[model samples]
Target: MIKLRPQPLRGRPTVSVVVPCYNYGRFLPDCVSGVLGQEEVEVDVVIVDDASPDGSSVVARRLAAADQRVRLIAHETNRGHIATYNEGLAVAEGEFVVLLSADDLLSPGSLARSVALLQAHPEVGMVYGFSPTFADRPPTPRTTARSWSIWPGLEWIEQMCRRMSNPVSTPEVVMRGSLMREFVGYDKRLPHAADLLLWLRAATRGPIGRINGADQAFYRKHGANMHVEMFAGVYTDIAERRRTFDILFDEDSACFPDGHQLREVALRSLAREALVTMCQAEKLGQVGDEPHDKLVALAAEMCPPERDPRLWRAYERTQTRSRSGRGPVVPRTVGRAMADLGGRIRWRRWRRTGLMSAVGSL
Candidate 1:
């Protein structure tokens, strides 16, 4: 167990915003400025250049020279993102820490808002705000009813498990430095979903807080995004999710004593994702057979034996639509008919089981 750092005395606590850059030299200044521009807060900015060929080190050094609070750590050799994060954490000295990517920008007052929430609620380990994902153009501002909301740790974890998707973007997140120090930096074995895992881990420790508007952060959707690579079949999202579940189970067995429920939730989530991916593939008719086969195989492994028939039926319908060039879109009447058919099938299944498995088997 790692020792927890003492909380700072009453006043504005320092925030260490670490910007890890690989080949994002052009966006480094914008990212650094976003951190420095935070309203009413003391921020220590650490810009880590991971031996980028694009002279990111030069930009980092310039930023450091311009501000006393800003510092640069340029790697002689290119270390992976995980290594750079750990290096930054090792050097960071702040009550709250944020690992902002060099390519992303934090919205105005984001740091102050996040810090205020953490200060108000000492029980929360991590706080994140809404981030609008955009490509090429900047996102327009949006309003919200409340500035922020608080969620109990376990409640937040349950919500994440149910959604099976990461709603918290990296730039919008602020973590308690002490809690972050408890664990080693991002897991190398699960690079694709390391941030998700970290958020879940933090949630296990305490409650989570969220600033409730898209104006908190701006997530740039470009070709270089790690998630885009994962979606393009460069890395296995399914396997990464599975590994994440296993890690969480091992770390917090007390929270999930059986592991059966968690496995089911994960499988169901994967099945849902697979269906969406299949729909996209069918609509485009461009995905290769190998990738599609892998998706099917993985889904089949997780799907319950009794629900296999339903899975096959859905697959056949999607394939038929794809080949017929009817596309993935369904007419209103056809959609209503399909929904009625599904209801009847679900009813029959429930009658046979003598219990309502509304949450159908994956």
Candidate 2:
């Protein structure tokens, strides 16, 4: 038998665009126009502003008032990302909903491709497309599979827990509006990984679908991206995600409990470690002990003995640089030591002193 590819859907499909906005005044116009531009398919814009001070609420209201297709929800007080998305999900009426960040812009007709997959495979819980970076500055280029041959039976929870990559990026994901409520929407506590957590369960529980396409959404990178803050303990968001996954999977005991994302969790931890290390190393020049040791403890949590390099020798390399009246030159040994030193710090002032573990060993 010849393996033939799935054909695209033929008719206009209903697609709802849910734009979760905050104080994103600059690029939001692109987000709105992107949704409205998909003329071939019916689209709805559900904009929820989490009490942004820069007048995003006013913008949302104006868009709602101007276009019958757009609906605006205003939060009197500042609600977080999860609550804002929940507000939009509660009232969205389209057959499928796509959450578009205010800072993101969609490639033309991206939604129609997603709608085509969902329309063809009625059994699938969610259909997601690829979203490569679209803003002019270098966007993070993500390459992943476009289609999956999902069978009628399997346990999604266990699979998600065991494998690290959830595959469904927040921007590329388009979901059946009804299924959003089938689960508890998004867990408000896991705001850091809320979208991933929800999509993980959705993809696993039902037959998952994917659309490989060149056109994707634009994820704007700037000083304000939440991921940068992840180093300051946001990446520990894995902890929150772990907590949520355990409880949710437990409630349905028939599904196995996942201790962690297993693969991605450690990779994410390493990334957070690198970020915390760089931030801490930078802070050592500008600030004092409290922030310093906070990173010290963070470094300990992040870098283990098998991974960390020797910081004492990294300082020695600095001494070498100082001797030559120039900046530090990291020697080969010292450089390796500098590369990994998270696991070798003291937890408390009273319990021990600055970095006792690797001194004698190094």
Candidate 3:
């Protein structure tokens, strides 16, 4: 469907939130209510039911009926999440767009806070904030956004490449409608890391904004979450993230001059990740399930021997044996200590900022 952008509202900005559901009927009410109850924004929710087996369509229809701000688009056949996302985004007529998963939720003032940043900084095309993850019930957010952080598009891309991770989760992102529509949709190829790639693409258009000192959304953690289901193991996650970068470089390398160097940075980061995972597996004697040899090979392939000798030597030491040729008992101790230090650093970062510095096998 061709979207006709609606005229700007008189006072509040109109935000079109696309809540995509697939067998998450139980969580639909909470998800949609959060979008509708957002303060200081005229919010319209487009609930796209992707032909779920659970009675999600019924719930969506009921939501649409209950409020004029809510609309339902039920697919007869399961076209998958990528298609569903594009279909819903294609119909967004509001000033801003949010692709919120049905299982997640927005914090009380998330949309309004994001809108404020976007409205103030015309250079920023995308705005995201901290999202705290929860299991059963979400914790109430106490603070409001105290300040905003804005980064140039290229700088943001560089940061992403250096870290080789996604900072913004799905629900935490609020995209400028025009910039969001610049891309066709979430790439069908990247079922695991489409959101990461999409955010990078958005950053190419303009600067990125972040809301600080407060939470933006609630990221629900469960058995059936997409990341948990798709990336069940370490190897799968590392490979998919590598694929995401490949597509990113292929599509938007021209946008940034240092794209080649950034690609190498991302590759090395991922390679180091594999090596780290290999060490952890060995120390825990979990090598059987984790595939130590494959991890070593992946690390070698990504970083290469000449790229970084220290990292390569770490990999080699993990494979070395004692004088009796038994196992890497001595090296395992060192690896375990290194792993513990890395975990502590990551924990500190996560505690300081609600965002995870690294995600999915990192």
Estimate the TM-score of every prediction. Answer: 0.81, 0.66, 0.87
lDDT (tens digit, per residue) of candidate 1 on 1-362: 11122222357679999899999999998889889987678899998899999999998998899999999999999989999998998788898999999999888777777777788778889987667667765676553315456777776666666666666778888998898888766877788889989988897888887765436778898766532342366128776886797788787777654467765776666665665565544443435543777777677776743665666676677778667977667664564465456546744543232112232221
Root-mean-square deviation of each candidate, in angstroms?
Answer: 8.4, 10.4, 5.7
Instruction: For candidate 3, list the clashing residue pairs, or say none.
Output: none
The residue-level lDDT of candidate 2 at 199 comes to 67
Find the candidate with the highest TM-score and give its number.
Answer: 3
Tell how far residue 161 is off in model 1, in angstroms: 1.8
Backbone steric clashes in candidate 3, count: 0
lDDT against the true structure, per candidate, is 0.72, 0.59, 0.79
Better of 1 and 2 by lDDT: 1
Best by lDDT: 3
Error of 1 at 138 (Å): 3.0
As a TM-score, model 3 comes out at 0.87
Better of 1 and 3 by TM-score: 3
Candidate 2 deviates by what RMSD? 10.4
Which portions of model 2 miss their true places by more than 4 Å? 1-6, 134-159, 224-235, 256-362
